[model samples]
Target: MTAKAKYQEVLDLGASLNIQNGDVKEENGTLKVWGTANTPYEKNLIWDKIKAIGGESPSDIMADIKVADNSVYHRHTVKSGETLGKIAIQYYGKASKYQDIFKANSDILKNPDVIHPDQELIIPNA
Candidate 1:
Protein backbone atom coordinates (compact mmCIF):
# COMPACT_ATOMS: atom_id res chain seq x y z
CA MET A 1 0.00 0.00 0.00
CA THR A 2 1.09 3.55 -0.62
CA ALA A 3 2.37 5.25 2.51
CA LYS A 4 -0.56 7.64 2.51
CA ALA A 5 -3.05 4.82 2.29
CA LYS A 6 -1.16 2.73 4.84
CA TYR A 7 -1.35 5.43 7.50
CA GLN A 8 -4.74 6.88 6.70
CA GLU A 9 -6.27 5.35 9.79
CA VAL A 10 -3.52 6.80 11.99
CA LEU A 11 -4.13 10.23 10.54
CA ASP A 12 -7.84 9.88 11.10
CA LEU A 13 -7.19 8.75 14.65
CA GLY A 14 -5.06 11.81 15.24
CA ALA A 15 -7.83 14.05 13.96
CA SER A 16 -10.34 12.36 16.21
CA LEU A 17 -8.11 13.12 19.15
CA ASN A 18 -8.02 16.81 18.15
CA ILE A 19 -4.29 16.80 17.73
CA GLN A 20 -2.75 20.23 17.26
CA ASN A 21 -0.26 21.24 14.57
CA GLY A 22 -0.81 17.99 12.73
CA ASP A 23 1.26 17.40 9.62
CA VAL A 24 1.57 14.37 7.36
CA LYS A 25 4.05 13.58 4.64
CA GLU A 26 4.59 10.49 2.59
CA GLU A 27 8.00 9.96 1.02
CA ASN A 28 9.91 6.95 -0.22
CA GLY A 29 7.35 4.41 0.97
CA THR A 30 7.19 5.81 4.47
CA LEU A 31 4.78 8.09 6.26
CA LYS A 32 5.91 10.80 8.66
CA VAL A 33 3.42 12.23 11.12
CA TRP A 34 3.83 15.18 13.43
CA GLY A 35 1.40 16.48 16.00
CA THR A 36 1.04 17.73 19.56
CA ALA A 37 -1.26 15.65 21.66
CA ASN A 38 -3.01 17.26 24.60
CA THR A 39 -1.75 14.66 27.02
CA PRO A 40 0.36 11.55 27.35
CA TYR A 41 -2.77 9.42 27.34
CA GLU A 42 -3.79 10.95 24.06
CA LYS A 43 -0.37 10.25 22.61
CA ASN A 44 -0.58 6.66 23.77
CA LEU A 45 -3.96 6.30 22.11
CA ILE A 46 -2.39 7.25 18.79
CA TRP A 47 0.52 4.86 19.29
CA ASP A 48 -1.88 2.09 20.25
CA LYS A 49 -3.79 2.57 17.02
CA ILE A 50 -0.58 2.64 15.02
CA LYS A 51 0.62 -0.63 16.56
CA ALA A 52 -2.76 -2.23 16.07
CA ILE A 53 -2.54 -1.42 12.37
CA GLY A 54 1.16 -2.13 11.82
CA GLY A 55 1.87 -4.77 14.50
CA GLU A 56 3.81 -4.39 17.76
CA SER A 57 6.39 -2.10 16.17
CA PRO A 58 5.84 -0.50 12.77
CA SER A 59 8.86 0.60 10.79
CA ASP A 60 6.72 2.05 8.00
CA ILE A 61 5.54 5.00 10.07
CA MET A 62 7.39 7.71 11.93
CA ALA A 63 5.39 9.75 14.42
CA ASP A 64 6.47 12.79 16.37
CA ILE A 65 3.90 13.13 19.07
CA LYS A 66 4.45 15.95 21.53
CA VAL A 67 2.39 16.52 24.59
CA ALA A 68 0.81 19.94 24.98
CA ASP A 69 1.00 19.83 28.76
CA ASN A 70 4.06 17.91 29.80
CA SER A 71 3.59 18.90 33.42
CA VAL A 72 0.23 17.15 33.69
CA TYR A 73 0.33 13.42 34.07
CA HIS A 74 -2.60 12.89 31.73
CA ARG A 75 -5.75 14.33 30.17
CA HIS A 76 -8.70 12.31 31.29
CA THR A 77 -11.97 12.10 29.45
CA VAL A 78 -14.70 11.72 31.98
CA LYS A 79 -16.97 8.70 31.89
CA SER A 80 -20.23 7.77 33.50
CA GLY A 81 -19.91 7.00 37.20
CA GLU A 82 -16.71 9.04 37.48
CA THR A 83 -16.41 11.80 40.05
CA LEU A 84 -13.75 14.41 40.59
CA GLY A 85 -12.59 12.74 43.79
CA LYS A 86 -12.53 9.37 42.06
CA ILE A 87 -10.45 10.82 39.27
CA ALA A 88 -8.20 12.56 41.78
CA ILE A 89 -7.55 9.30 43.55
CA GLN A 90 -6.66 7.69 40.26
CA TYR A 91 -4.05 10.33 39.48
CA TYR A 92 -2.92 11.76 42.83
CA GLY A 93 -3.52 8.69 44.95
CA LYS A 94 -5.67 10.87 47.22
CA ALA A 95 -9.36 11.61 46.87
CA SER A 96 -8.75 14.98 48.56
CA LYS A 97 -7.00 16.19 45.47
CA TYR A 98 -10.36 16.50 43.72
CA GLN A 99 -10.17 20.21 44.46
CA ASP A 100 -7.09 20.42 42.34
CA ILE A 101 -8.82 18.85 39.38
CA PHE A 102 -11.84 21.03 40.02
CA LYS A 103 -9.74 24.17 39.93
CA ALA A 104 -7.94 23.01 36.83
CA ASN A 105 -11.19 22.41 34.94
CA SER A 106 -13.14 25.32 36.38
CA ASP A 107 -13.58 26.79 32.92
CA ILE A 108 -15.98 24.02 31.97
CA LEU A 109 -16.75 22.44 35.27
CA LYS A 110 -19.02 24.48 37.53
CA ASN A 111 -19.02 22.06 40.45
CA PRO A 112 -16.46 19.62 41.71
CA ASP A 113 -19.19 17.01 42.11
CA VAL A 114 -20.31 17.17 38.49
CA ILE A 115 -18.57 15.90 35.40
CA HIS A 116 -20.15 14.38 32.32
CA PRO A 117 -19.09 11.61 30.03
CA ASP A 118 -16.64 12.55 27.29
CA GLN A 119 -15.72 15.81 29.01
CA GLU A 120 -11.97 16.17 28.87
CA LEU A 121 -10.21 17.20 32.10
CA ILE A 122 -6.57 17.95 32.71
CA ILE A 123 -4.88 16.02 35.49
CA PRO A 124 -2.45 18.64 36.68
CA ASN A 125 1.07 17.90 37.91
CA ALA A 126 1.44 16.84 41.51
Candidate 2:
Protein backbone atom coordinates (compact mmCIF):
# COMPACT_ATOMS: atom_id res chain seq x y z
CA MET A 1 0.00 0.00 0.00
CA THR A 2 1.09 3.58 -0.52
CA ALA A 3 2.53 5.27 2.59
CA LYS A 4 -0.40 7.68 2.80
CA ALA A 5 -2.89 4.87 2.48
CA LYS A 6 -1.04 2.74 5.02
CA TYR A 7 -1.31 5.47 7.66
CA GLN A 8 -4.73 6.80 6.83
CA GLU A 9 -6.02 5.84 10.26
CA VAL A 10 -3.34 7.96 11.90
CA LEU A 11 -4.32 10.95 9.78
CA ASP A 12 -7.97 10.43 10.64
CA LEU A 13 -7.12 10.27 14.33
CA GLY A 14 -5.30 13.58 14.03
CA ALA A 15 -8.36 15.13 12.42
CA SER A 16 -10.55 13.85 15.25
CA LEU A 17 -8.28 15.61 17.70
CA ASN A 18 -8.48 18.88 15.78
CA ILE A 19 -4.74 19.04 15.27
CA GLN A 20 -3.48 22.47 14.30
CA ASN A 21 -1.38 23.14 11.22
CA GLY A 22 -1.75 19.53 10.19
CA ASP A 23 0.14 18.27 7.14
CA VAL A 24 0.19 14.81 5.66
CA LYS A 25 2.48 13.66 2.88
CA GLU A 26 4.12 10.53 1.65
CA GLU A 27 7.88 10.66 1.26
CA ASN A 28 10.13 7.76 0.24
CA GLY A 29 7.49 5.23 1.13
CA THR A 30 7.02 6.72 4.57
CA LEU A 31 4.00 8.62 5.80
CA LYS A 32 4.95 12.00 7.23
CA VAL A 33 2.53 13.73 9.61
CA TRP A 34 3.15 17.04 11.31
CA GLY A 35 0.83 18.90 13.64
CA THR A 36 0.35 20.53 17.01
CA ALA A 37 -1.77 18.80 19.64
CA ASN A 38 -3.47 20.68 22.42
CA THR A 39 -1.91 18.49 25.06
CA PRO A 40 0.61 15.71 25.58
CA TYR A 41 -2.20 13.28 26.12
CA GLU A 42 -3.59 14.08 22.67
CA LYS A 43 -0.16 13.62 21.09
CA ASN A 44 0.20 10.27 22.81
CA LEU A 45 -3.23 9.30 21.50
CA ILE A 46 -2.03 9.85 17.94
CA TRP A 47 1.06 7.75 18.58
CA ASP A 48 -1.11 5.07 20.14
CA LYS A 49 -3.25 5.00 17.01
CA ILE A 50 -0.18 4.79 14.79
CA LYS A 51 1.27 1.97 16.85
CA ALA A 52 -2.05 0.19 16.89
CA ILE A 53 -2.11 0.11 13.11
CA GLY A 54 1.63 -0.41 12.50
CA GLY A 55 3.00 -2.30 15.57
CA GLU A 56 5.36 -1.02 18.22
CA SER A 57 7.92 1.55 17.08
CA PRO A 58 6.57 1.47 13.53
CA SER A 59 9.13 2.57 10.94
CA ASP A 60 6.54 3.32 8.29
CA ILE A 61 5.26 6.52 9.81
CA MET A 62 7.20 9.62 10.78
CA ALA A 63 5.05 11.91 12.88
CA ASP A 64 6.04 15.29 14.28
CA ILE A 65 3.51 16.01 16.98
CA LYS A 66 4.08 19.12 19.02
CA VAL A 67 2.20 20.06 22.16
CA ALA A 68 0.65 23.51 21.79
CA ASP A 69 1.03 24.47 25.45
CA ASN A 70 4.70 24.21 26.16
CA SER A 71 4.40 26.45 29.18
CA VAL A 72 2.55 23.76 31.11
CA TYR A 73 4.32 20.50 31.84
CA HIS A 74 1.29 18.37 31.06
CA ARG A 75 -2.39 17.80 31.93
CA HIS A 76 -3.52 15.67 34.84
CA THR A 77 -6.80 13.78 34.91
CA VAL A 78 -7.80 13.75 38.56
CA LYS A 79 -8.53 10.39 40.11
CA SER A 80 -9.97 9.27 43.40
CA GLY A 81 -7.85 10.27 46.42
CA GLU A 82 -5.89 12.67 44.24
CA THR A 83 -5.30 16.15 45.62
CA LEU A 84 -3.58 19.18 44.18
CA GLY A 85 -0.63 18.50 46.43
CA LYS A 86 -0.43 14.90 45.32
CA ILE A 87 -0.70 15.85 41.68
CA ALA A 88 1.78 18.63 42.18
CA ILE A 89 4.31 16.25 43.69
CA GLN A 90 3.92 13.88 40.78
CA TYR A 91 4.89 16.57 38.24
CA TYR A 92 6.86 19.14 40.19
CA GLY A 93 8.55 16.78 42.69
CA LYS A 94 7.54 19.17 45.50
CA ALA A 95 4.24 18.82 47.28
CA SER A 96 4.61 22.44 48.30
CA LYS A 97 3.95 23.48 44.72
CA TYR A 98 0.31 22.58 45.15
CA GLN A 99 -0.51 26.27 45.19
CA ASP A 100 0.81 26.60 41.68
CA ILE A 101 -1.45 23.85 40.48
CA PHE A 102 -4.41 25.41 42.29
CA LYS A 103 -3.67 28.74 40.68
CA ALA A 104 -3.34 27.19 37.26
CA ASN A 105 -6.68 25.46 37.56
CA SER A 106 -8.43 28.16 39.54
CA ASP A 107 -11.24 28.30 36.99
CA ILE A 108 -12.47 24.91 38.14
CA LEU A 109 -10.78 24.50 41.49
CA LYS A 110 -12.07 26.55 44.38
CA ASN A 111 -9.78 25.06 47.00
CA PRO A 112 -6.42 23.33 46.85
CA ASP A 113 -7.67 20.59 49.15
CA VAL A 114 -10.64 19.74 47.00
CA ILE A 115 -10.44 18.13 43.56
CA HIS A 116 -12.92 15.81 41.92
CA PRO A 117 -12.21 12.69 39.96
CA ASP A 118 -12.08 12.95 36.16
CA GLN A 119 -11.40 16.68 36.32
CA GLU A 120 -8.62 17.65 33.93
CA LEU A 121 -6.03 19.92 35.56
CA ILE A 122 -3.25 21.83 33.87
CA ILE A 123 0.18 21.34 35.41
CA PRO A 124 1.75 24.69 34.77
CA ASN A 125 5.44 25.40 34.27
CA ALA A 126 7.49 25.50 37.44
Candidate 3:
Protein backbone atom coordinates (compact mmCIF):
# COMPACT_ATOMS: atom_id res chain seq x y z
CA MET A 1 0.00 0.00 0.00
CA THR A 2 1.03 3.61 -0.52
CA ALA A 3 2.37 5.61 2.44
CA LYS A 4 -0.64 7.96 2.35
CA ALA A 5 -3.00 4.95 2.33
CA LYS A 6 -1.23 3.41 5.31
CA TYR A 7 -1.43 6.69 7.18
CA GLN A 8 -5.13 7.03 6.43
CA GLU A 9 -5.73 3.46 7.55
CA VAL A 10 -4.04 4.11 10.86
CA LEU A 11 -6.00 7.37 11.31
CA ASP A 12 -9.24 5.52 10.56
CA LEU A 13 -8.39 2.87 13.14
CA GLY A 14 -7.58 5.54 15.71
CA ALA A 15 -10.88 7.29 15.05
CA SER A 16 -12.68 3.94 15.29
CA LEU A 17 -11.22 3.45 18.76
CA ASN A 18 -13.16 6.59 19.85
CA ILE A 19 -10.37 7.75 22.12
CA GLN A 20 -11.27 10.99 23.84
CA ASN A 21 -8.78 13.84 24.25
CA GLY A 22 -8.47 12.99 27.94
CA ASP A 23 -7.79 9.28 27.35
CA VAL A 24 -4.70 10.01 25.20
CA LYS A 25 -1.53 10.98 27.00
CA GLU A 26 2.04 11.17 25.77
CA GLU A 27 4.41 9.56 28.26
CA ASN A 28 7.95 8.19 27.95
CA GLY A 29 7.99 8.18 24.13
CA THR A 30 4.64 6.43 23.87
CA LEU A 31 0.94 7.36 23.99
CA LYS A 32 -1.06 5.59 26.69
CA VAL A 33 -4.67 5.57 27.77
CA TRP A 34 -5.05 6.96 31.28
CA GLY A 35 -8.67 7.42 32.27
CA THR A 36 -12.28 6.75 31.30
CA ALA A 37 -15.07 9.22 30.48
CA ASN A 38 -18.40 9.04 32.24
CA THR A 39 -20.69 9.51 29.28
CA PRO A 40 -19.17 7.09 26.75
CA TYR A 41 -18.33 3.74 28.30
CA GLU A 42 -18.55 2.20 24.80
CA LYS A 43 -15.63 4.41 23.71
CA ASN A 44 -13.56 3.00 26.58
CA LEU A 45 -14.43 -0.52 25.42
CA ILE A 46 -13.32 0.39 21.91
CA TRP A 47 -10.11 1.86 23.28
CA ASP A 48 -9.46 -1.38 25.16
CA LYS A 49 -9.98 -3.38 21.96
CA ILE A 50 -7.60 -1.05 20.13
CA LYS A 51 -5.04 -1.48 22.91
CA ALA A 52 -5.45 -5.25 22.64
CA ILE A 53 -4.66 -4.99 18.92
CA GLY A 54 -1.50 -3.01 19.73
CA GLY A 55 -2.71 0.06 17.91
CA GLU A 56 -0.82 3.26 18.44
CA SER A 57 -2.22 6.76 19.06
CA PRO A 58 -3.13 9.06 16.16
CA SER A 59 -0.05 11.18 16.80
CA ASP A 60 2.17 8.07 16.71
CA ILE A 61 0.77 7.18 13.26
CA MET A 62 1.67 10.62 11.83
CA ALA A 63 4.85 11.44 9.90
CA ASP A 64 7.53 13.21 11.95
CA ILE A 65 8.28 16.07 9.56
CA LYS A 66 9.55 19.29 11.04
CA VAL A 67 7.15 22.21 11.26
CA ALA A 68 8.07 25.88 11.45
CA ASP A 69 5.65 28.49 12.78
CA ASN A 70 2.72 26.08 12.52
CA SER A 71 3.50 25.45 8.85
CA VAL A 72 5.32 22.41 7.52
CA TYR A 73 7.67 23.29 4.70
CA HIS A 74 8.43 20.43 2.34
CA ARG A 75 12.05 19.66 1.51
CA HIS A 76 11.76 18.30 -2.01
CA THR A 77 14.74 16.67 -3.70
CA VAL A 78 14.49 17.28 -7.39
CA LYS A 79 14.22 14.20 -9.61
CA SER A 80 15.58 13.82 -13.19
CA GLY A 81 12.24 14.40 -14.97
CA GLU A 82 10.66 16.73 -12.39
CA THR A 83 10.22 20.42 -13.11
CA LEU A 84 9.63 23.42 -10.87
CA GLY A 85 6.02 23.51 -12.04
CA LYS A 86 5.51 19.91 -10.98
CA ILE A 87 7.20 20.50 -7.65
CA ALA A 88 5.05 23.57 -6.98
CA ILE A 89 1.86 21.65 -7.76
CA GLN A 90 2.96 18.77 -5.56
CA TYR A 91 3.85 21.00 -2.63
CA TYR A 92 1.50 23.97 -2.84
CA GLY A 93 -1.44 22.28 -4.57
CA LYS A 94 -1.10 24.74 -7.47
CA ALA A 95 1.33 25.16 -10.37
CA SER A 96 1.01 28.95 -10.15
CA LYS A 97 2.97 28.81 -6.89
CA TYR A 98 6.08 27.75 -8.82
CA GLN A 99 7.34 31.31 -8.66
CA ASP A 100 6.85 31.30 -4.90
CA ILE A 101 9.04 28.24 -4.55
CA PHE A 102 11.49 29.69 -7.07
CA LYS A 103 11.68 32.89 -5.04
CA ALA A 104 12.14 30.96 -1.77
CA ASN A 105 15.13 28.87 -3.00
CA SER A 106 16.71 31.42 -5.29
CA ASP A 107 20.18 30.69 -3.90
CA ILE A 108 19.98 26.97 -4.73
CA LEU A 109 17.79 27.22 -7.84
CA LYS A 110 19.91 29.64 -9.89
CA ASN A 111 18.03 28.60 -12.99
CA PRO A 112 14.37 27.56 -12.78
CA ASP A 113 14.79 25.37 -15.88
CA VAL A 114 17.78 23.42 -14.57
CA ILE A 115 17.07 21.17 -11.59
CA HIS A 116 18.66 17.79 -10.92
CA PRO A 117 18.23 14.92 -8.50
CA ASP A 118 19.45 15.47 -4.89
CA GLN A 119 19.09 19.24 -5.22
CA GLU A 120 17.13 20.18 -2.11
CA LEU A 121 14.35 22.69 -2.75
CA ILE A 122 12.55 24.49 0.03
CA ILE A 123 8.82 24.52 -0.62
CA PRO A 124 7.62 27.62 1.17
CA ASN A 125 4.19 28.09 2.69
CA ALA A 126 1.57 28.83 0.05
Quick one: best TM-score, which candidate?
Answer: 1
**TM-score, model 3 to reference:** 0.47
TM-score of each: 0.65, 0.60, 0.47
Q: lDDT per prediction?
A: 0.88, 0.86, 0.55
Per-residue lDDT for 4-90 in model 1, tens only?
797788899899989999999987888999999988767877998899888997888899999997877698889999999899888
The residue-by-residue lDDT of candidate 2 on 18-122, one tens digit each, is: 999999888788888899998776787888898898999888889899999777767889999988888877876799999998999999998888899999998
Task: Please give the clash total of every predicted structure, in order.
Answer: 0, 0, 0
Candidate 1 lDDT for residue 79 = 91
- Give every collision pair in model 2: none
Angstrom error of the Cα, residue 46, model 1: value is: 0.7
Among all windows of 10 consecutive residues in model 2, the one with the lowest summed lDDT is 39-48
lDDT tens per residue, model 3, 27-111: 4444443332222323334454444444555443222212222232556778889999998877656888888888988998788
